[model samples]
Target chain A: MKRTITLTVNNRPGVLNRITNLFSKRNYNIESITVGHSELEGVSRITCVVNVDNENIIEQITKQLNKQVDVLKVTDISDQAIVSRELALIKVLSTPNTRSEINALIEPFRATIVDIGKDSLVIQLTGESEKIEAFIELIKPYGIKELARTGTTAFLRGTQRTSNSTKNISIV
Target chain B: MLQETAFTKMKADNKPISGSELLLQALEKEQVEVIFGYPGGAVLPLYDKIYDSKILHVLPRHEQGGIHAAEGYARITGKPGVVIVTSGPGATNIVTGLTDAMMDSLPLVVFTGQVATGVIGSDAFQEADILGITTPITKYNYQVRNIEDIPYIVKEAFYIASSGRPGPVLIDIPKDIATAISEPPEEKEINIPGYQPTLQPNYLQIRKLTEAVSSAKKPVILAGAGVLHAKAAAELKQYAEQQQIPVVHTLLGLGGFPAEHDLSLGMAGMHGCYTANMALYEADLLINIGARFDDRLTGNLESFAPNATVAHVDIDPAEIGKNVPTEIPIVADAKEALKQLVAQEGKLPEHKEWLTQLQNWKKEYPYFYDNTSSLKPQKVLEMLFEKTKGEAIVVTDVGQHQMWAAQYYKFSKANRWVTSGGLGTMGFGLPASIGASFADRDACVLAILGDGGFQMSTQELAVIKEFNLPIKIIILNNMALGMVRQWQELFYEGRFSHSKNPVQPSFVKLAEAYDIKGYEINSVEEAETILNEVFSNNEPALLDFRVDPNENVYPMVPAGKGSHEMVGVKP
Candidate 1:
């Protein structure tokens, strides 16, 4: 069975390497993962999206991490119904005419203009994954100069907060 | 074939496997009956698989207690003990239990879950490098990366654990591998070179040792746990009688020799009889069978049995000269070595005078207890034997009460007594009793534990409750760590160190909580009559006897002191 598992690990060194190694060792192809320091000190959230055979193995994989004293919490946000977003900062080659059209196209996606130059334009967009993908697709026509994108991060649907459980690692 | 998609084709034969599933299959293949575990992140996959498996799993109150039960099971039945745990803290908690089993030379397999491979090097949450931590203590250790290696690693772990000078083997399974899939694991095999445990008896050496026994003027046989584990009791008993020599035992050596026999010296050393210790101090020949010469027994080693020539038999060759020097060392199984010695057809020696000497010592010391107007633990032990008539397999946890049981209880044959002698391990009796009763389901097995030791692993009462196996628990409620307290009083100027943990759990209430039969005896009549009822009923019973607070075990010879220096009383 193909599945993606999201893990919120403490922000610490080697977590990315360890998670990637976990996938590589098991041959779990890591499609993408977004990780960074969260609002909490000494803690980080990691969202790993992978295609794998068993969804239950996430429990096993994360439980192993939970056994690590430093690891605060692990969760699978894969199936949660929520807004998933990725931030992309792309520098596109732009003429004044295309830049105007680019700014117009970026308007609906709520992207921002970070920089402007005679030769290039930089646009930053954050939205649900599908919207971000559409924004990237629209800007691809301008001939991309540089692209840096943070992977998907999500939270549960209307008023269904996952914060309390994460605060005190409840396995059930 | 057109009917099946490429993805389906790949799913049928080729797929990436994780370390977790491999671990689960390996355990399944080992036919592991049960595992005791408390789940955390690193081992979550292993637990997840456990959820799907049919194997029995016990959740212990603590990690150390989990493996202690495993050790007890292994020691009692001669099987490999298996415990599963998460990495880091969970894995580290089990080290003491592993160490205890290692010191006793027991067979145990401990499996710990590790963080994923990629996150291991990084200071990832909950990550601990367990392989580095357990290397010094374990007999063998492995960290598997590939799913194909799981079956092989687990098979070898069990083999290395139970074979030869038995000790613990640890396997660390990374979480990622648990989720990995394999095309069909390879036939598991042990491929490491030169790892065979020695099993054959050395015939020439056995012949020489037998000759020495035949020619000795004052030969005494000393048996230990090896005799019981190897089931060499009958051979040892016949051989001693044939040669007409007395048998002296270590604390662990108790039931390996019949306490009531003419040749039986019960136990020797600190608490041993006046004659047995004195005779051993003067004997011309010492047949050390299966028991290590613990320092507690051999005071001033240079002065111990000064005239005796030693013939040692043990499975571990390293133990032959590890402590007291051996005149002749035969590295072989205790049962096989004894069998070979018996097969040599040697003539019996003349030791009636020596036998008389031990008999005189038996009369002199004769493990005594004052018959008070009220109840005493001695009376309970006496009643336990009389009511059961020495038919029960009696287990004693280490402490003052253990020595008392060794002295008062009579074994018609060997292998019926199981105690943690080498380790002097507390909390050994209860779980061992469970395992022993499991071995002989029809036999009446009783565990004698102190209040201190009972409190340590009393959670095993849950197991007792689940099974209702008719094993009687006799708790000597002294309200202190009796053994350590005795030492503090004798050697530490009586400062009353941490040995005194004054507050005690209500054992009767605890018994009720487990829903087992429970009673308390304050009067001698209550002890004798209630004990008879507990024994006759044959249900699992617990007897909490409030004992004297300041009572000290007699025949106390401080460590490193000679037999002449043994203090039978305070100055």
Candidate 2:
């Protein structure tokens, strides 16, 4: 199973390397990682998906991450009600004949046709990770000239926050 | 014109000293009396400043020795050990010590010099990415980019290293940063938003534990290094006595309570006494104070303390329920938790039958050895204790000697027994004893080493000679890696692959080469006389006791087996 661990860290140089290095050295296989600025200034939120066997792996990793000086907070929101998003851009071969059909396929998923060239059309989609995967599968037969993904970034639903002030979850 | 220029420079100096100078001032503020280090190109400026400063710098032959000595000082004195080493190899050399200290929870603040800031990432000559290398091994680490940040970083390093569940902290200072002009920050309270530790445990949990303690008929207390780190030995002993509970300690937690106390059950783990393991297994209530339930302590976790309702008290919240399931968890300092537990009044339950059962086990399976062998290692420890009357502070390197030291040498006082319990690093004893000697000038410090472990850091003999530290190094020469050899004998059909040392040096000559008196004893009679001479004369000496190479530590609970499943030494 894959678990998503969200961390709020000091927005400083080398914080990213410090975190990734821990994953590499400790042999935690990171499936995807996304980093961006958080609502709080001077703090960045990092969401990482790692392939793990059980909750014990998350507990160990979270404890190790919490020990890092640059890391402010670590929470495994995998079991929580979370709103997750991933963005991907796919360029599919088009003959001008298949372009309208591609547009129609993307329209139902709320995706957009951002670019059109004689050889191909570039489709941009932002949605839940599964939705992005489904859209990519729909366009794969048209020939994926190029592809890129933003990885998975997530936050808990509603007003629940993973903040420094929030009581730490017990190390279960 | 020359005088005017000199005066101008002097006036500028009054504004604030260079970063190196401010570092000295910070050390003074931390009241760091000694620093263990070796000089190098990157740290030349810091070294030069140290030369003119009041802080004593003891140069070791190797950087590893410096850090281990620092660890010894920290473990014995209950102070954060300080280390300063140059870049590249200097920084890399201390990795083992850093890892060892981290695993054992020894408090240390290490400062490693880096190449000038301009050449940092370019990988200039003698430059290493120390912060990157030490990230996982240290409790916390920093790279000082600005000279102004030196005071704060150093202060915070000390605070973090010495505070709750102490471990090593490092600051990688580039050369340019050290030479840049900067004033020491005002001595102010440090509040790291991300680093606050829970000092007070939940009182409701304590109340629950007190209720359990009052009703339990068979209760035992297990103490660990946390007791020493929190300086809670007195409180722990008080709680045990008031509750009339038998106290068993982990290896590193030996001295936290008197080994001679009737209620004390010596070291409960692999190579632990039979009675202690039995008590841990059969107890109805197990109170764990400041001890992580390490695999060694809680063998076969599913079956560990099967009959017990466990209440764990530790400072690190992450350690609770980490390895073993606990009915009640209290996150607080050992001293604070023990203090609270002591204050609670409850109807104390007496388990006279349980105590008597443990006594019978102890008497029947007392740690025994036949002195008729060439020179028994256990006999050496016994005589050392008899000669010193168990008054010396004994530090040990890992392997058979370390186990025998824990078993044979009784520590009746706190902070008297120090060893590499977690990492079990070889070659820790000699230099650590040097650090311990520095901590107490009048005390007799013994470094008990296995032949294999002694050779790893024997170069530290120079420190002993230079400082004339009253540290006695005893090498139990079995001519093999005794611990590994024992395992191979039992579990590997006696293949004995590479565990035995094919060739050995004369330890007496090695000690003599360093200008310290040396003795070699192959018999119990010789050991008794030589040990007495060294003790009475108060001279630093190394005694090589050649013991039976085939001897193995018994009352063994093999890895992953429950304490109740001990294989040797019948009760």
Candidate 3:
């Protein structure tokens, strides 16, 4: 099973090292992780995707992550209603002959041409992970020159919030 | 001229001092009385401050010895041990001790000096990436980059090291930070958001536990070091007696429950007693209080307590279901949980038939040894226990002798037995006993070792002689690594490899060289008189006993086998 976990941590030196060291030490498989500044000052939110076999392992990983001193809170939003997105840049090998065809193919997916080179066009897309995978498969026929992706970043849907939102903002 | 003017201006209003002095003040504020440390070039600044400070420093010959001594002190006194050393080699030497303390949950605060801040990543002289090396082993670690952060970092280090689920913490201080002069930082409250530990159990969970206890017929309580760490031995004893339940101890939990009690089942693990292991195998309700299900404690998890429902109580939430599938999980301090169970309104059902069955097993398969031929290690341990009246703080190095000591010594009080249970490090006994002796001057401290282990840290004998600590050292010289030899004989078809020691040193002569009293015993008949003389003397002494070389520790559970299928049980 795959789990999506969100963590609020102190924005300090080696905080990322500490979190990743914990994952490697405990033998947890990390699929992807994205870290950025949170809503609070001097605090960061880490959205991570991990693959484990059972619910018990997920619980164990959450508890272990919570043990780090810099980590403020850990929330497993895998089973909850979550709004998630991932940004990807795909450079497709193309010539002037297939440019219109490529533009027409990406129009329905709301992807835009961010860059155009002599023999390639870079398309930037933001959506759920599954949608990005489908887009890559559709454009594979044109030959992908290069690709880069920002791993999944997520939030709970509606009014539900993680425990850190209820904490005082001055703690960080 | 500008530098002098600025210095004078700073000293006029707010007094500024070096980071080393600030660290000393911080340690004094924490009520630290003694420190076990070794000095080097990287830590020269701190050592200069230590020279004028009032704190007493004990220098072991090696860095590893100092840390092990600190661990021993922590185990006996329930206080976090403090250690300081220099960079590179000095810092690397204490890695084993750090891992040992981490695995066994001993509280330790170790400070390691680093190269100058500018040269840290440039591979300058005596530089090591200690923080990266120790991240997995330490509960928490820090590196001081600024001089003003010294006071709070020291305070936080002590707090985190001694708090819930106690373990080792390390702080790496750069040379420039230690030498820099700055105004002392204001005292701040220690606030760590993610580090809060649950100290009290949920009332609903307590109610459920009591209900389970009331309905259990063949209940057993498995205790571990957490009981001792929480100082809840008395509470555990009361609950077990009130419920008429049998209690089995993990290796580190030997002294947490009285071995003389009628409901006591001594030590359940690989080398555990037959009755204790059998009770766990046949238990109907296994109420595990603070013991992690280590693989040695649970042989072949598929067959381990298959008939029982396990209820695990641990302070660390991560340990609850890591190895075994727990039916009831309580994350709280062991002492608090035990008190709640005792105070709950409930009466447990009587288990008369179960008690009888356990008693029969105890009588049928008691721990024994053949005493007709050669001197035996078990016999020597029995004599030591009788001589000390089971009151001494018994520490043993890792090997066959460690198992014998755990088996023969019946501890009736908490915090009286110390051994390297988790990491099983060699050469831990001698220095740890030296550390244990400092806990109380009047209490007798014993270091039981094997020939192979004693030589690993033999340099620590100088510390005993210099301090004149009243420590009794016993070396069971079998001329081989006894545990490995035994395994090779049974599992590897007697190949023996390099297990046998063809050459050895005269340990008694080595003790004499250190200006300590030394005695040697070669026969079983002379063992009693020699042991008597060594124990009665007030001075430190070492005893070398040449025991049988091929004798093996029995009542063994083969790897991947069930506990009930133990070999060497007397019919």
Candidate 4:
């Protein structure tokens, strides 16, 4: 199964290298990773989606990540109530006849046609990964010229902070 | 070089000192007494500072020897070993020692020099990615980019290296940083919010463990290096004796309990005694304190202690239920948990039947080898133990001789038996023994090495002679890698391959070359006389005993086999 893990690390030099080195050393397969400054000052949050075989691997990964010197916190919020989103810019071939049909298909999905070209239309979609996939499937018949995804990033739905332990002592 | 004199001139001025001065001050603050090192070009600044400081510096012939000697010092004194090495090969040389310390959980603080920060990635002379190479092997590592961060980083390195499940920590110092000007650090505890280790055990869990111990019909305590690291030997002994439980140790756990005590079952695992292995196999409750259940100790996981309800106590939470399932997992220091467990009331009756069964097995299947051959390795250790009256601090290199020493020499106290238990580094004994000797000059220190392993770091003999350390070095000349040769004989149709040593160096000549006392013995009759004379002299000496080359460590549990299926036991 694919799991999303968010790691809060101290904003210090060589931290990213350390995190990536740790993953490679432990043979953890990282599918995608997105890092940016978190709400906490002088700290960065890394959202990583990795492919793992079992729950035990996730536990080991989290424990190992917690052992890193710069990593302040690690949480596998994969099973929690989360708001997950992905952004994709997909270019699809649109003839004069198929342009209106494409508009009709993306009308309910709230996707926007960001660019119109002579040979194709570039559609920008930002939603849950499943919604993005649905939009792509509908537009596939029009022939996708190119596609780029920012990958899935997520956070808990409530005000619960990962740094503070919740009452739920789930999987230790 | 001028910075040292300037810092000394302005010592009372409250002026900012050079980075080297700050480094020395941090060492003084930590109360470090000794540093094992081999200086080089990149570390000249630190070396100059060291010369001005009051700390004792031990210069080994090689960088690897320096690290192992530091390890020896750490193991004996219960202090974090400190090392200073230059960049490139100097930093890379300590990899084996670092891995050994990491595997065995020894506390070490190593400082390595790097090229100037500007030239780090430019392929400058004597530059290497030391932090990158050592990240996985060390407990924690840091690269000192800013000279101002020196104090905080040093404090953090020491804290991490010596706290909860201690291991090696490395700090890479760029040349420019060390030469830059620095100021005195504020007197306060360095706050690292991410590094708090849990020391106290959960009382509820301790209660559960005590209950299980009280009700267990056949209980055994399997202690490991964690007991020694936590300084919990007293608590462990009391808990076992009060509960009338037999204690078996992992190889590294020797001396954690008195080996001669009736409740002690010696060591357990592949080359462990029959009594200890049998007790582990038959126990109804196994209380493992600080042991990680390494493959050598556990054998087949599915069949290991099948009848036991395990209660594992360790400082590292990741070790719990990692290899084997646990009924009660208490994440805490072994000493604290054992103290709490011992405080609980209720005197459990002695399991006389189980104890007698273990005794019978011990008498029936005792560790034995053919004694008809001349110069038996076990006989050599037995004689050494007799000569020393089991009162020496013995360090060993890895091989059959190491196992022989483990089985034959009785270590009655913790920290007295030092060996490379985890990484099994070949060149550990001589340097480590030299380090141990420095820890206590009055104590008899012995280095038990195989012929092949003794050659690996014999260069340290020069350092030993230079220091006039009265370390007795014994080389059991088996002329082959006995352990691997035995494995091939038993499991691989006896294809010796590279195990045999066709050509060998004359160790006595090497000792003579170093101007140390040297002796040679190849027959059983000469062992007592030679050992007695050499040991009585109380000087650094080497004795090469040409033991039976075909000797093998027996009472072996084939790899991945259950401890119950030990082979090579004689009637």
Question: Which candidate leads in TM-score?
Answer: 3
Every model's DockQ = 0.01, 0.45, 0.63, 0.55
Candidate 4 Cα outliers beyond 4 Å, as residue runs:
A91-105, A116-121, A133-146, A159-172, B1-12
Clashing pairs in 4: none
Q: Place model 3 in a CAPRI quality band.
A: medium
- lDDT for each residue of candidate 1 in A1-172, tens digit (9 for 90 to 100): 4334555565644456555655554355666788777777866777666665664455445543442323455666555556577888999999977878988888888899999898998899887667878888888888999998887776556865555564577669
Report candidate 1's interface RMSD in Å.
Answer: 17.5
| Chain B of candidate 2 vs. true chain B, TM | 0.96
Grade the docking of candidate 2.
acceptable
Please tell me which model should have the higher TM-score, number 2 or number 3. Answer: 3
Model 4 per-residue lDDT tens digits across residues B284-387: 99999999999999899888999999999999987888788899999999999999988998657558999999888877888787787688989899899999
Model 1 chain B: lowest-lDDT 10 consecutive positions: B1-10
Query: Across residues B1-571, which tens digit of lDDT does each residue of candidate 3 receive?
Result: 1122332343355788788877877777677767999999899999998997777799999999999999998998888889999999989999999999999999999999999999989998989999999998999999998998888898999989988899999999999888999975676889887789899998888888888888887889999999999999999999998888899999898998999899998888888999999999998899999888898888888889888878989999889988888888999999999999989999757789999999999888899889888899889999999999999999899999999999999999999888999999999999998888887778888899999999999999999999899899999889999999999999999999999999998888999999998888888678889878878876899999999998999788889998888888773
DockQ measured for candidate 2: 0.45
Query: Candidate 1 — which residues are off by over 4 angstroms?
Result: A1-172, B1-25, B188-192, B413-415, B431-443, B569-571
**lDDT tens per residue, model 2, A38-126:** 99999999999899987777888898788676789999988777899999998899997888888889998999889989889888999
Q: Write the per-residue lDDT of candidate 1 for residues B276-357, one digit (tens) a residue.
A: 6777787888888887788877766878888888888887765676567788988778888877777787766766777786
lDDT of 1 at B366: 72
lDDT of each: 0.74, 0.88, 0.90, 0.88
Best by DockQ: 3
Q: What local lDDT score does residue B21 receive in model 1, on the 0 to 100 scale?
A: 54
